[model samples]
Target chain A: MKAEKILEALGEIDEKFIEEAMNYNMKKKFNWKPIIAVAACAAFALAAIPVANHFANNDMVDGGTTAGTVAPVPGDEVDDDVDYVAYEYSVNKGEIIGNHVVELKVSKSRGRYVIKDKLDTQKTVYLNGMEWTAKYENSWSETDYKVIVDRYTGVCNGRNMSFGVNSITGKCEFFMFKTTGDIDKTVKLTRDELYEIAYDNFLSGGYTEDPENYQLSDECSNGSAGYWFKFTRFVDGIETSEHVRIGLRNNGDLYWFVGNRIGEMKDVDVSGFDMDKIYDAIEIKVKKIYGDAYVDFEREGAVLRKRTDGSYVFDYSGHIDVKNSYGKVVQERCFLIVIMD
Target chain B: MTDETILEMLFARSEESISAIDEKYGHKCRKMALGILGNEQDAEECVNDAYLGLWNAIPPERPSSLAAFLYGVLRKLSLKKYRANTAGKRCSYYSDALDEIESTFASAETVESALEGKYLVEAMREFILTLNEENRAVFLRRYWFMESCREIAAALGTSEKNVTVRLTRTREKLRKFLEERGVEI
Candidate 1:
């Protein structure tokens, strides 16, 4: 078979697949919360500088107090309505960029944005009668400062769970919470309990995938770090490439969470096609392709995703690698799909 | 604008339909042609010709997906242009893609009955419909769209090496698929 024949045949494929490839479907809505959190960190740091200066001046004159317990007094300038411009700073470029200015809501009473010039120092402040802390980590190699404590909603054993956000995309990249005590290697929460916690957190974080579409699997529960849970998206009992992974500490605390929403998968009816014949045909085709070449079949699955035009395409059924007699990969990620209809 | 609305305008012979299509899918169509021809001037001319082709076909034919229809037409036109441009000398990018597929089955010396184009197309379509979403996207983007590996990589948010590797394996798979179905090389 000539390759041009194959190319011409490909040109005649169903329009649904052509339209599926037309748009990559990797649309990511720039999340604003993490950017707001980054801005709030900067604003709080700016708002705290004056208070710290005031405390320093008073301590120099009368030695009343120094850098400690410097609370904003009632009827002070803190009650005035003020606007703090939180510019989106590009850490990679080492400069403040973008026209998006998030207005920081500085609390008039006790929600003082407190940040210290020192590195690796955490400042605790009372906001809405809840203890909120701002922790800063300054990389000595780079001049960019990462303020990592704006969305701190949970605390385990007096430690706040911190999540790193991509400064440009504003998506929550990863969550990290290390255990301190001897409870590092213990399973404190059952799989069901972990699912409940992860599901609630997943929903609260504004992720919009249905829980029913995902098949939950406890990947690792006996590791030294914590339990690793993955929620893989599947359609017609065939797994897709999208998943959400959550890692929990032995004390039932969330230590790691990373989710991918690039390719949106949807459930479709495949009852029309005989899947057994399809798999069998695919297997035969694979063997013929490799011949005597060493083949490594990694995954046999299907992908069904909704196109931009609201049509569903269920394809990319399987993947394998073909190596030559010398054990070198001749073809990598061989994609094969068979549709009888 | 929605495809239906633009299509209605096209059906009603409104000249605004051209601008609407140019607004909605002009950049993509041009990018597709550029990926195939690898020249800005040739790609621009090819897209214009493709638009003319679309205008001529819509009155006699109503496609369910206008984007797909335009894509198919543009792909044909771009390949035609590529063949004309690379007739004497070797052009690398799109020709490289073609050669990758050619190498899959070009080595065969056996003489047998050639498979009909219709069956080959049918088998190819059936084979394509079975691919997973990402691989299908990559395959169509490279082969059908005539996009370079670099363009495919950028569009799919993957590396060029990954796209090239997938294309190689996919071409091999296509060869095996056709051969098992009694297609002679």
Candidate 2:
């Protein structure tokens, strides 16, 4: 059982054994050429047909347009009560990139919306009256131009709300969507009261809270049945924002609506407010005034927190409050806002 | 070369088939058989039996991996020879090895029955693959080829006791792996 014996055995394969094995194999008979030929033909056909068709239909087609196109204009008249409007615009031939340019036409009649991005020279957009000033910036990589929309506030079912378009991504990011239908009549809850409700909810396991410890802010929202909350917490001296929205069904089933945004406020009137500029301006003002104090703000359902080191974090929830620059509560229910410094 | 090509050459009763198999896998198959059977004559006989089995099988069956198929045949032949030659010999090497593996395959009733069929071979292959390369090589050399603990130790550049410990742990792991994969062993 020594290593040398094993090595010797491994090295000493008998030639006679192989000869016998060969003889044994020679006596057996099987015909497999037909099966192999069929399989090979099938494999070849599968790999070729679709590829040839794709190459054959590579030609581009001209897309047709309908009627007059609306040009981009500042201070366009908008109805205050209206949810959305449609406008047509065209991207000139000089602005087209690569071998093709797709113009996405978006039209909204009432709250219903439709977006069509076809291979064409012209594009139309149906935007909400509140989001009329949303600007679009094209990028070399992505087909859609980055849209920057100003921020705005509204009340729904007693909750204050805000939303805006991302300056870089043209994506609509919500700030707050609190039910503000009866904001004037309902008694407003203070920050401390809101914190107690959240804490109690967590302790009783009645609310599903985030595992990460985030500092509570005024940014919150109220949805169809329940609410949403967002907080920013400092871990290892680094600030991180965590947002969660919980919906409580009548049968006591809890559903989570968590994302990076608080509400769909980016597609609304809040498009005029340049949140990035506002955040930068506030950070400067807070550092100058507060002098190293931990500064945070919440509006609609968006929360922004800044540590003494100047590192900031942004998060939103659909069931939170939106606050203004002066720390005054704007939305009564849940909505988020960007806080300073 | 493919199993089909080897089988076709084998079925044609070609001398080149023997030469081709030896050229492709003689060393590996012989080494594996030697590791389990221990005796050179027994291992050689197992390899010969494997070739005979392959010759008989190829008329109906075409293996995907000829080397694996040959190795399996040799292993079964060697194990069967070991059982027949050592029957009722309580103090023999075969008895000792069987005793060592008894606890793992206690429910199998017979060692040959336990080791037979595709399930056992597949389980062993999977278990061996999961082991660290060095440990797997040592285990294969010791158990499958019937090499001694000292041989495994020297080959792996470790102490005999370390080889024993590794073998024990690997056997336990193989046992667990097989059991988890729904094998009685």
Candidate 3:
């Protein structure tokens, strides 16, 4: 029909349908957690630098330890006029280079000297601790430093590293951890698990390697935050590999982003099942456990749905399964209800 | 107006509610129903049915826009009635019009495809918001209220052919708008 006619028909519609639809909307209230999480993330960024300093002061360094200094060079000192080159870290490994300062956080506890960056801030690095100071040079590439340990004591690992941030390569490097064992073992997390890990990392401090490069705000106290996670997995016994990246913005909202493709869960409800085993988990439960109602399961995209008597159903979209409590798939059919409503 | 006010008046079976709706939108609703059904009796019946539906629905339902809510209900009822009455008829005007527009999507094998649930409604809302006030009113009058080209022209003080052209252009715009938002047609 003509658009105008269709609009007219829509305009002339009876009031009952509108009421019913509105009632449905009221019944299914929109989740506000994601919005609150985003707001909290913004607040955290504003107050992050000061809080880091506050914690650093309480956990202060001993006297005689070398403190690195960084300052912007005078414009008249150099004949060449270059806009301030914000230092950043490379995209490789677990480091994130940014325009201001490089930041990285390691999950596991490694040796002492191995944790410190090449900058001569301090020899000892503490967990959840940040050290910020000024550098002498105008450019990062021009400076050089070595990773040193007290030779007489011989208490820490001896791993020397140095780099410079110049106009040609204006990048600041932040190293998190060094893996000595199998890298495969370190990366074997399901998409949901990886998202949770990443989200936690972002919440604690921040990740340097994030493409979004979200930083903590100065005004943020402590609330919920969001982040993304990417992990590499070996699928087949043969030579085949795949990268699984999941976008996790809210505490419970998990979005699938495979390769270059990104979309919300189609028909799945990610509320049920363990978030850790979300990769290949199937949950089956009776919708009306003691009743005569039969449950049916349907798959849409990577999600599963459970319905009872073709009316009420539960969605298990982006969740991972750890236990198959519903019995074997080859035997009798099983159904799981993720959400009660 | 607040839904509480509407509901309070509706549940009380207040003549004021009916009078208020009639005084404000009765002619407009009648014109739209007549445009779609092409019969005065059916159009009047649709409007009365709309009132009764509104009376019954207000207690549990709170609508953001009373006019839009009423229009939506009336349209559904009108369409259902039209379908039932013309079940075995040979190409009724209302059926023909719907079929002509619906055929394009049917041929593309997307006529049966649901509009991704709420996305379709959202898209339609967005599309309506983009039109100019006059055009938006005209569009709503014709499609939502089911007013004829002649009736719309009379209401807007324009020619019937101009109304037709404007409607055609609007349809094309809507089609493109829906397609951009990933709707099949």
lDDT score, candidate 2 = 0.41
Q: DockQ for every model, please.
A: 0.20, 0.02, 0.05
Q: Residues A22-123, candidate 2, lDDT per residue (tens digit)?
A: 212110122335455345434433433443343234321111111111211222332333222112222232212111121112222212112222111122
Q: Evaluated against the true chain A, what TM-score does chain A of model 3 have?
A: 0.16
Q: Which ten residues in a row have the lowest lDDT in candidate 3 chain A?
A: A146-155
**Least lDDT summed over 10 consecutive residues: which range in candidate 1 chain A?**
A138-147
True-structure RMSD, every candidate: 25.4, 30.2, 26.8
Error of 1 at A8 (Å): 1.8
Query: Which candidate number would show the highest lDDT if scored against the true structure?
Result: 1
**Cα lDDT of all candidates, in order?**
0.53, 0.41, 0.39
Provide the DockQ value for model 3: 0.05
lDDT by residue (tens digit), candidate 3, B43-158: 78999999889878885776766767776777777776665566556233355445434533423344225343345455667777677655665555555555556755644445
DockQ: which is higher, 2 or 3?
3
Weakest ten-residue segment in model 1 chain B by summed lDDT: B107-116
Kept native contacts, fraction for each prediction = 0.54, 0.00, 0.10
Candidate maximizing TM-score: 1
